[model samples]
Structure formats: C-alpha cells, structure tokens
Target: MELRDDQPMQHEIGNRTYIVADVDPLDVDGVRTVEVGSALWLLGFLALLPFYGELEANGRVWWLWACLAGFGLGLFGLEYCRRRRKARAERDGLDHG
Candidate 1:
C-alpha cells in the first residue's frame, strides 16, 4: 500500500492501483479509531470498579454508575458499527461475483 505525498491514497495491490483525493480515505484510520475506542471503553469499565470506594468515601452519586453503563453501551455500539460495516463490505464483494 502506497500513501503518496501528492495524493491522499495511491495504493497498488498486484497490478491494480487505487487513488482517492483529499478526503477521509479508507486504510488504517478506522482500525486506529476502533482500537483507541476499545481501550477507552475498557478503562471506563475499570473506572466503575473503583466507584464503590468513591461512594463509601464521599456521598452517593448514581451518575457514576450511569457513566460506567454508558461506557459499556458505547463499547457495544462501536463493536456493532464495526461489524456492520465489515459485513456490508463483505456482502458487496460477494454481490460483485
């Protein structure tokens, strides 16, 4: 895969080459985002484990639990979105054949 200085993405696989101009190109950005989001979600979940301690030390706040639940939901949503995109791409490939 070739990322040209002039063009956004100029990649050659086998004998075929693909070129895309100045836009959010499809290569590694999505993968990186997914990885980062997954890590954040994991950390958020870990944060929940310490919430009990925080509750005991300070007063009670249900928002902490809500935030943790939201993070878990976000993780699931991200995974679902990624899977859906991959499944659509695969289906498209099969449709061409």
Candidate 2:
C-alpha cells in the first residue's frame, strides 16, 4: 500500500504491530547506513581483541582504539539522525500511529 506523507504508517506482522513515523525515505536509508556502519566498527573492534596484547607490545594498539572511536561516533550519529527524523515527522503531524 502507498503511504501518505501526512500520516504515520502502521503494519502488522504475525502477532506484532509496528507503528512507523513518516519521514523521507532517503533519511531512513541514511539511518540504516549509520546503524550498519556502527555494527561493522564494533565487529572490527571485537576482531582485534585477540591481538590486543601483541598490538600493545608493538605500540600499534591505536588501530583497535580507532575502531572503537568509530563505533562510538557512528552510534552517536545514528541516534542523532533518528531523533531528527522523528522530530521532523512530529512537526509534520505524522507522528501518530
């Protein structure tokens, strides 16, 4: 079904219902990208855990730190974007489900 810009959208899957705020599709895409990027950064940090000792010994632990920083920044960006989208939806009177 086509979604209207003036209203929130609702969908049901099995026994669960989902209420979605209406926002630009491109903004949603960007949020997804941030989420995925954050996950990847976290994964990279975890992958480097086993080599932590060696990296520290070689004074190259900055790589792991960089990944952690990226993960943090990505998470912050994700939340910021999500909030902005929600606020925009609310301002447009599309927040009610």
Candidate 3:
C-alpha cells in the first residue's frame, strides 16, 4: 500500500496496527538546551559543596566531580551545536539579517 507524503505512517504487526504521527521535528539548535543543562549541572555541584566532607566520608565525592564533568562537556556540546546551527541556517538561507 502507498501512502501520501503528508500522511502518517501505518504499520501492522501481529494483531495491532500502529499509526505514527507525520509531524515535523522541532527546529531547535540545542544550544539553549546545552546551556540549561550545563547551568543545572553547575548548580548541582554548588549545592553539593557544603556536604563535601560527608560525601568524601561516604566515598561519594565522585558525584560532585561528575557534575563538573557534565558542565564541562555541555560547554563543548554548546559550542558544537551553535556552529552546526549556524552552518545549517546558512545552507538553508535562513541566516538573513
């Protein structure tokens, strides 16, 4: 069976038919997401700072370090996503001033 370009996907498996929506994906560049994530991670690390001694006593100090790592990695991801979004916009002629 043929489906129209704008039609949702329909798959029949076993005794059930699944219909997937044919909606367009969001055009987010992910820079904001990364920034928010990085901020959250930094917040988590700061919030855990006061309990550092207890964390070290319990051998869970890695949790704080993990948050720092997440923030660092998110910084890298933010830059990459920003560059990717710029390139995509330029390619699609959506970078108009």
Candidate 4:
C-alpha cells in the first residue's frame, strides 16, 4: 500500500518510530525538584539531631538552620544549572536567533 504525502505518517520511510511529546528528560529539571529533594533530605537528617541534647534539652536547635541551608543550596544549584544549560544551548545554536 502507498501512503499519501499530504497526510502525517506514523512511520518514516524505513522504520516505525514512536514520536514522544515530551522528548527532553531534563526539560523540567529546575529549582523546584532540587529544593524539594534537599528539603526532604535535610528534614530526615534533622530529625536525628535531638540526640545532641543533654538531659533532654541542652543543645542548639540547628534543624531550622539546616533546612534553610538546604533551601539556599538548592536554589543556588538550580540557578547555576540553568545558566549552564542556557550557555550550552546558546553555543549549540538551539536558542532562537
């Protein structure tokens, strides 16, 4: 059977290939996921900090700071990764001229 040229074909000349709408895996890689993952890890680590307290209550409450630090690091990493990716895209001429 012959395929019509006007119509969009599911397969190309030789092989049958599947077309995916979301082709880029890192398309959604950004500050959001990093922040969330860091927050979770920090929270897990902080939950064990209570052991540092003597007589049930004698140590510094650093879990809050830990969370903040994780947040900051996540944000920074997101920004850095974004800029790096942008630079790469620009070098590759992927960005709109």
What TM-scores do the predictions have?
Answer: 0.43, 0.65, 0.77, 0.44
Candidate 1 lDDT over 1-97, as tens digits, reads 7765765467888999988566775543154465576677667657766677777577655656665666677677677767766777687684311
Query: Residue 76 lDDT in model 3?
Result: 92
- In candidate 1, position 23 carries an lDDT of 72
TM-score of model number 4 = 0.44
* lDDT per residue as tens, model 3, 1-97: 8756757488899999999876777888788899999999999999999999999999999999999999999999988998999899899989732
Tens digits of per-residue lDDT, candidate 2, 1-97, equal 7765666478889999999875566545268789999999999999999999999999999999999999999989998988887878888888722
| lDDT scores in order | 0.64, 0.86, 0.90, 0.62
- Candidates arranged by lDDT, highest first: 3, 2, 1, 4
Stretches of candidate 2 off by over 4 Å are 1-29
TM-score computed on alpha carbons, candidate 2:
0.65
**Residue 50 accuracy (lDDT) in model 1:** 68
List the candidate numbers ranked by TM-score, top first.
3, 2, 4, 1
Regions more than 4 Å wrong, model 4: 1-35, 38-60
> Top lDDT: which candidate number?
3
Worst 10 residues of 4 by lDDT: 20-29
**Predictions: Cα RMSD each:** 10.3, 10.1, 3.7, 9.8
Q: What's model 1's lDDT at 76?
A: 76
Which number leads on TM-score? 3
Estimate candidate 1's RMSD in Å.
10.3
